[model samples]
Target: MLTVNKTDLVRHHVPVTMADRFAFRLVGGLSTVASVLFSKRYGNRAVVLETVAAVPAMVSATLLHLRCLRRMVDDHGWIRTLMVEAENQRAHLMSFVAIARPSGWQRFLIVLAQGAFYNSYFLLHLLSPRTAYRVAGYMSEQAIQGYTRYLEDLESGVQTDIEAPAFAIDYWHLSPQAKISEMLVSMRADEAIHRDIQHAFADALVAGKLLPDLPATDLDAGSSIGLDEKRLDAS
Candidate 1:
């Protein structure tokens, strides 16, 4: 099993603050929207390049988000958290490979194609790290709510400490509250995972394995597929 340094997680998060998680979701949504708009104006090529560059960021964010989620849920039982985290991780890794499966010849022709694109936007937003972090915080809150709902659905009798969000993706015809709640929760979970990916890049930077820069594209924006056991088995 692959593991990272737990020391990076400073405090024991019996229950994390909802503020940061919700903030993260907002930023993530904004970032995705911004990326899409940029792509529309610039062309899909630029978006593709940016997506490649943002891979590390995507991975870091996803990993850290999941890590925190696992810690929170797993405090009660590893079996459950492991099940969810593994599923989520597999989805993330698969998505990474799918988006990055360009031809080797094309890759060779375009050096740092992905990195250049991802970093360009990241740099623009660099001055506002706190704001960026708040985006991540929002996402975190939503994910907790969303995942709790999933658990609630699975084990109907189980009582989660947090209230399950009233909305879900499949049920998109609901009211404003339900719809917004669903989006927030789902986006929050995604942001947490995305944050872990950014952290991974940070680790690489610390190790001198990579240089600092913004990801060119928004890697997490495209895919909506969730991780499942079948996907894990195939991988």
Candidate 2:
């Protein structure tokens, strides 16, 4: 089970380079577009966003795998780490799909968005993996904020705190009586972990390190690399 530190939920990466700035602005633009499209419909928003969120990890893993093959060198466990992240994001999508029950038009929009984002991110990764990771980092930050809003709505009775889907319960090992608010909290923590990992990858790239010595936060443990402490102290 994943244990989320409250500090991780509020951690933010301060942009330093032009690439980081561009990535931050890019995600901000997308967040605005999502807000205009979804408004207060957080469930539907999650379904669409999770579909796009699941892309970068798989793309990065594929490209890195091929790069390692070509160079006959080790990937230093990055391939598995990215693959796990991809699977985790996919699980999030499944959980939200069950809860949101998106309509046909929303489903169609999901396909279009996923297709466009996948291809664009693929090309961006080819050109600059550092910026690609930075974009993902900022995007995860947006997701955290979105989920936080959802939690607030649930708490304030603006949205009903419905029972969590069975899939989410099983995936997260939640209690049978878990509410959607609880699920949102777990998902928010997952997004925080993604945010930290992506920013760490971008930082490693900026420092000219091929692979960073991150903490061993494997799929089973559901732990993060603990970047928040250092970042918070620095801030």
Candidate 3:
């Protein structure tokens, strides 16, 4: 289980080095460009964008797990947050999988993208966790933008508003008859939460005052993934 002082979170986060700041900014820039190109290539970019959304969290969690193992100390709340984020994004990807019904080539593209992203993100986190986190924050911004556009399409009748997936309804506590726009709203909220967390983690890293040794129990009891099992059940 993870623990946090919500009070501090609002004001405190990792403070970053110049190099890390630059690297993170560069990634954010590239992400913006990618979002544009992806939308141009695909009708809706949510499926592919959300597929890669889980990358940073998974990468961070793996590293934090190993760090915890080697040092035999608490990883603050980073592990739980990262893992929860990964699971939440997985849900987003899952819902979109059913709705988007990606083509075979798109599916293969997912595999390739995940493989490349996972390795690249892992190395980046290893070299500089701060920058890696910033990258995730940027990626979440991209996700939000894509989902917003999808919602716009639905509202404008460019695309029909479809019934929300059962999993989305149950997991989100959305109206049983909720539609895709409602689901997208819930998802965007989740992305905003992650975006904040990523920035905070980056700030914590910069502050150099974030980590403190802890007892054996994990510090991740609270996370957005609290809804994950229910979402899975609906699936």
Candidate 4:
């Protein structure tokens, strides 16, 4: 995994177009709702947020695959990039699940929220992929902010700095004695990459580009951490 510099942790995309404004407002509304529901319970919030976060990449990859097939053109690596992103997000969800140990009702809420978000995002992507990507980028920015606050709480002794989950340590190549604060730092780096990639995709679409290169984050080369199917299922 690439090391995340201070600049990477604080990046944000400015909204200019009407579509960009729409995405900004939409993410803001969702963030408000998340705050209302979870308050400062960042662990539980992460479980639900990561569950929903895993959806858009899979949806984009599926649609792009179909589009490539229909047009008889190569995807230029976008499919694999999106699939890796989905896998990374899934790893995040599973790690948080271990940390949070969510209740049965919370799990049910996750299911409902995931289904609702998947359908809504699928429709949005179909209608306007550029705007959809912008929404994703903005959502990731919000995730970075949330994780930063979570880290602050951990560091300030507001939230307990628990030992990192075993799966998290293995997945992120973290030290055996790592704590949840370290895991959050790693996860925040992942979110920073996601934010950049999503905005890059949106910018490419807006520019009428056929093949958009992945950002210098180098996540497309598998620099980001991921878990295999068997390992994920075991976790």
Error of 3 at 9 (Å): 16
Q: How do the residues 97-163 of candidate 1 rate in per-residue lDDT, one tens digit apiece? A: 3333545654553456445544643542354433333343333333334334444543564432233
Residue-level lDDT of model 2, residues 13-87, one tens digit each, is 988899989999999998888888988688888889899999998998898899889988887677777777788
TM-score of 1: 0.26
Those runs of model 1 whose alpha carbons end farther than 4 Å from true positions after fitting are 1-124, 157-235
Better of 1 and 4 by lDDT: 4
Work out the TM-score per prediction: 0.26, 0.90, 0.77, 0.90
Q: Using alpha carbons, what is the TM-score of model 2?
A: 0.90
Model 4 quality (TM-score): 0.90
Summed over model 2, clashes come to 0
- Each candidate: what lDDT? 0.36, 0.82, 0.68, 0.82
Candidate 3's displacement at residue 101, Å, is 0.8
Native-referenced Cα lDDT, model 1: 0.36
lDDT of 4 by residue, 46-107 (tens): 89889999988888889889988998998767778778888888988999989888889888
